[model samples]
Target chain A: MRDVYIIGAGIHPFGRHDLSGLEQGVAAARDALKDAGADWQDMQFAFGGSLAAGNADAMLPIMGLSTMQFINVANGCATGGSALLSGYWSIKSEEFDMGIVVGFDKHPRGAFNADPKASGLPQWYGDQGLMLTTQFFGMKIQRYKELYGISDETLGKVAEKAFQNGSLTPHAWRREPVDLDTIMNSQMVSDPLTKFMFCSPAEGGAALILASEEKMKQLGAKGVLMRGASVRTRPQGSFEVFSPSLDVERGGTPTEVASKAVYEMAGIGPEEIDIAQIQDTESGAEIMHMSENGFCADGDQEKLIQDGDTKIGGKLPINTDGGCLACGEPIGASGLRQVYENVIQLRGDAGDRQVPGNPRLGYTQVYGAPGLSACTILSAA
Target chain B: MAELLDKEEILKLEPLAEGLFRLDNGVPVLLGGKNKETGKIVFPMPSGAEAERFDVVPLKRTGKLWSWTVQRFRPKTPPYRGPGDDKNFQPYAVGYVELEDQVIVETRIMGDPDQTLKIGMEMELALEPFELGDEDKYVSTFAFKPVA
Candidate 1:
């Protein structure tokens, strides 16, 4: 099998750019090309993920930007990750020596138009008041409090941690300081999840350049080998309560199952990982990620956060790019945005938020499918 | 979309081609429809008992703020058509009730969206109209009432 590598990476901040969707994508794509020391003409194909099509009008971001070859994808919040998966496969399969994956979107003002007719929620209006991702995740936070006796103080502390880190990143949606009192008093967006606990919806774009080993050698790019990339969906569908893709009882989910399969195939373990990013659509999700990534027990992800191990200077830095928590939750751009953090860290470009002791192995995870999930593990050559 | 079948009709539908728990044993249950596209058999979320049964016991909730968020605008599905006569219900509390059985079900809350939500609070599910009604049919949906 060919060893594919990420040669280029670029991103705009996680808030609204006030630019057209295609313009945002083009800007990011140009940076990616420049970062890789490769030009747009050198890209063999392009895959784009944009959550809001209405904002962009006809001809997608990829079609507007790339002339050679293209495909566009949108899987709810997982669109960005899906784009990366497709680009990786294209280059790894020798269909293209180099592939460009771009994800960008300015979230619609309110709830995303999930076309409720398609989602099988038992709601009268599909998911009028109850379907926002924050509401569902808030349910999990409530459940955790019921079990662990986590204090409101603890949750505020978690919020403070994210904001403190967000302040460090110029691209974070929220860069202000949030103290324990500020987090506790913050307005509620969902139950148990204060506004601070929830990642804001922002307009943003991120791009990645993928190249086969031979292509990277020709270009002389310092790279992280795309060790393994895999995607999985719930056997039943996105809403099935019994999804193997998320947190199961004792073990990680089908998404974790897919990710573990990647690690097994690459002959690596989670302990070997140095830097990581997991999708945190909600604060509770970051907890689930620890156990899902073998960092903790299923309901015990909060302990990791509470203990400060999930912090920047702690063991195995995560979401070092402020995560989706600090970074805005741009549905189409989130997944690839996670991947961007890992690439920046691996290539040693991360400035203040950079993990100490120069990390080698990094992983990025995204969940979509109308709730399908994907994890991509990248490592230094 | 549920029909409260009369007791007699409920007994008569038994021995259906499907839905039989066991022929002459327990209640027969019918599962998913056949997937004509994939020529594959599929069964959606299945329930062994009905709300009326109330026998097997629902895992009760002690308490918890399962999660909460604002419904910034009206939904795009049934029950919500343009602005109804009364707009008092705009931006309502959207939440999930985490039953003791680890069951997480979505619901509307009894309080305001900006209210402080405590996790692990006792929660009970109640049926209500999905939104402001048209004075005709009521679309039944679940809502959570804190079990203080």
Candidate 2:
């Protein structure tokens, strides 16, 4: 099988814009093309990722760019990462030399967006309640803090450091520095989780171009060959409807399952990872992710983050881009955004946010819709 | 969306088995009536691992405030017309109750239509109906009451 690597990564500043989803897709795709210094004309196939917009790929690419045909795919929050997985499968099969995956999202208009998994009737008909996505995680957050005694400050530490780093990055959704007090004082969304502990909804786009080893040599692909690209759904046997146990239900807890598979597939272990990007829609999800993915044992994550172990200079740099908590949560684009950060870290182009010394393996976790989860592993090694 | 029917006439708020409808693994299901329009919560069923008995009382007590909403405008469907001249029940209140055993239940609240409900409130189940009706084929339903 021909080795595949991400040759170019691109994304639009993930914030609200007047442009439509299709326009965002085009802009993001162009950014990837520019980063790779390759023309869209050279593309063999494409996978356009968008969560809500209908049939977005057909309208994104510049017309007559090698007449390259593209396929559209969506996996809810995992849309972009799953798109990356699909692109990898096709490229490694030698059907396509290069593929591009792009995802775009803007928060819903009017009433809070309804959760499709709610099992209840339509919001227009049933009193489903106004569920702020981040706040909806309130139940689990309350339990986790109670179980672990993780102070609000430890959660804030990530916010204080991450958003500051995001502020420096041109593409981050939130660019403001936040202190622990600021985070604690933020409006209460759910018990124990204030507004700052939640990710703000924003508009953004993320695009990545992947090429097979054969194509990379032809295009002079530099740095960070795709050591591992994996996207997975929760095990069918394990998937359940409305598990009352808060621990089992939050964001699908797939980091454990995915990490086990990814490590075996990437031939790497958690200890080998220099940097990791966890999906932290709410501050609590971040810590739970640390435990579920074997980054730390239960309750140990508090010490890990409070002691600065997950920070850039700590034992492992997690969410060097401030996470969704500090960064905006642009649903469709958020998953790919994780990949974008990993790419930048592996490429050593993370600027001031870059970790000390050259890092090697990077892990990205995208857990969502309460149980739909996927993890991608990238290595510059 | 069905019409907001006379919930009292349609639902029979009887205990399915007087807390007998327990999970095979010994988990008990809470049953009761929560006023869909009044936002009142009532628990009418027994919970927890209790032995079968005559005149049985409930053993379970904890529940999570799952989700909630005030009845905005008239309900989409039902025989529910508020106590006004207009036929449309323009505003009411209602939501779901998730108990400790992870049972999601429906309930109603008595409040101004403009009042908002916070998710995860400490709500207990109650026996009541959002819509009242005269003597007919009387059916019953459950409701919820906010625990102080």
- DockQ per model, Cα: 0.18, 0.07
lDDT of 1 by residue, A1-381 (tens): 577899999887777667876667767777788899997777788888787743322333444454677777866666787788888889877888987888888765544454444564332334234444444565556656667566666667666777777888877887876787877787665556677777767788889999998888899987778888877765432232312111112233556665786677568988888877887776766765666667666555556667788778888777887777788777777888888888888877788887888788998778754446778889876
What value of lDDT does candidate 1 attain over all alpha carbons?
0.64
* True-structure lDDT of candidate 2: 0.64
Residue-level lDDT of model 2, residues A78-101, one tens digit each, is 777778888888887888888777
lDDT score at residue A36, model 1, on the 0-100 scale: 92
lDDT of 2 by residue, B1-148 (tens): 1134334433343421233223223233343433344333333332333212213324233455555444333322122322332254444455445665333544454345445455667776444332332222222233465676
Per-model TM values vs. the true structure: 0.75, 0.74
Chain A vs. true chain A, TM-score per model, equals 0.89, 0.90
Query: With candidate 2 superimposed using the best TM-score fit, by how many Å does residue B87's alpha carbon deviate from the native?
Result: 27
lDDT score for residue A178 of model 2: 78
RMSD of each: 7.8, 9.2
What DockQ class does candidate 2 belong to?
incorrect
What's the TM for model 1? 0.75
lDDT string, candidate 1, B59-109, tens digits: 332334454455544554442432343344456776544443234445567
